[model samples]
Target: MAVPQFQHLAGRVWVCPGDPDPEAVQAGVAVVADERGSVLIDAGQSPTHAREIQAALTAAGLPQPRWLVYTHHHWDHVWGACAWPGVEIVGHETAVPLLRTEAARPWSHHYLDEQVRANPRLGPSFRARARAMDSWADFAVLPPTRTFADVDELPVGVGLRHVGGGHAPDSTIVLVPDSGVMLLGDCYYPPPAHLRRPDDGLDLVLVRRLLQDDYLWYVSSHAEPMTAEQARSAVETT
Candidate 1:
């Protein structure tokens, strides 16, 4: 896939579109900025993906991002943390232990191959992506520098809210109230296909919340921004 570019969505918000490459699935990265500096939504899938964000920001003439926030602990969401050294990383409190466990283990091409062999979730496609990366020399999960349970307010009035969903119990959304934009990571997506089926009840509950909240634009990790009408239909049909 071509390197994704950040498209301006609303006040102080821009998002790099997600990659559809199955072997290297990548989530969209959102940037919220003002005089306080920019805060990135998710760090992308790998160093190459993160650097794509960096290059896009530079090309757009935006300042370096000041913070990196994980919407959850999924590999595609948090594995790119090493690319943002010194950037304050934030995540839901539930993510700390999950990440720490991975941090304690050794990661190598062989280790990854073995993981794919032993873990159904990390299937053949995951192994393919691991082998495709230009390098894994700098890959590592740096646990969040700070974490919160329910809600955490950041500079520029951005709000990080933990609204755990079926895809991930630590799922969170980035709320840019002033701009009426909400960034929904993988929260609305169904659990991985190999995992237990999605909970329809849970999906409905979150969909209701999104509709009631009525954000002007809803950004999901794997798709383009949506209008209220579009967002509602998108989630309901999922």
Candidate 2:
């Protein structure tokens, strides 16, 4: 339904669009940008979403992404990463082992067909977009050009830490300390706030141990932004 959309947060963090069910309120991409460039939390469902993310990066005075972090190995989150150039993909160590080298899996193969079978409630060009995700030309993802087993924190400019794992086994969260914000790739969505289906929440015990108080802004790849308190609270509920 109209390509996709992006939502801004505190004027720095942002979320882009994806192959979300048109009626769902929670679909799309979640992006984290700082002075260095932009780091998309999730690349989104299809390759077509690259333009939407590129526009956001441009508006923020950045170039094509220098880095990207996938929340997990799900096709919706990692498959479209090929759209951004010169990016050093980063994710958990196990991530690579889980994804397919080919996009011919039953789940992905059929899911695209589902879109085609359902036809244009998605406004104009929905079928064309669906075909793109199915075609290899649209995306050639690399789950994580760089990986971390336990933890790997890098300088994302503005004194921040891009943390990895602890969520679906490959989740990553980027934290900006001075601003008290943590750009969670996919580790922090509440049990059922997803723009798509139910993924429940993540490992509260391990996740709790991983978090530091310096984090204040907790932005999920699925839901809107949150606070440290909100992060703690949500974890407790889980």
Clashing pairs in 1: none
Candidate 2 TM-score versus the reference = 0.67
Task: Output candidate 2 Cα RMSD.
Answer: 6.2
lDDT of 2: 0.58
Task: Please identify model 1 stretches exceeding 4 Å from their true place.
Answer: 128-132, 198-202, 235-238
Candidate 2: regions farther than 4 A off: 2-12, 17-30, 101-138, 157-167, 188-211, 233-238
Model 2: per-residue Cα lDDT at residue 16: 62
TM-score of every candidate: 0.91, 0.67
**How well is each residue in 95-173 modelled by candidate 1, as lDDT tens digits?**
9999999788777777777877888776754665575466868677788889999999887688999999888889999
Query: What's the lDDT for residue 136 in model 2?
Result: 51
Q: Which lDDT tens digits does candidate 2 get at residues 1-238? A: 5645566665455656444453332235655566666566666555555656667656656445567776666555665677777778777777787764534444344554676467634322334434545465545656577877765665665222334433455555555555566665555433322222455446566568756777666665555566778878877886
Candidate 1: Cα lDDT at 180 = 86
RMSD of each: 2.2, 6.2
Clashing pairs in 2: 16-29, 26-195, 27-195, 180-216, 180-217, 181-217
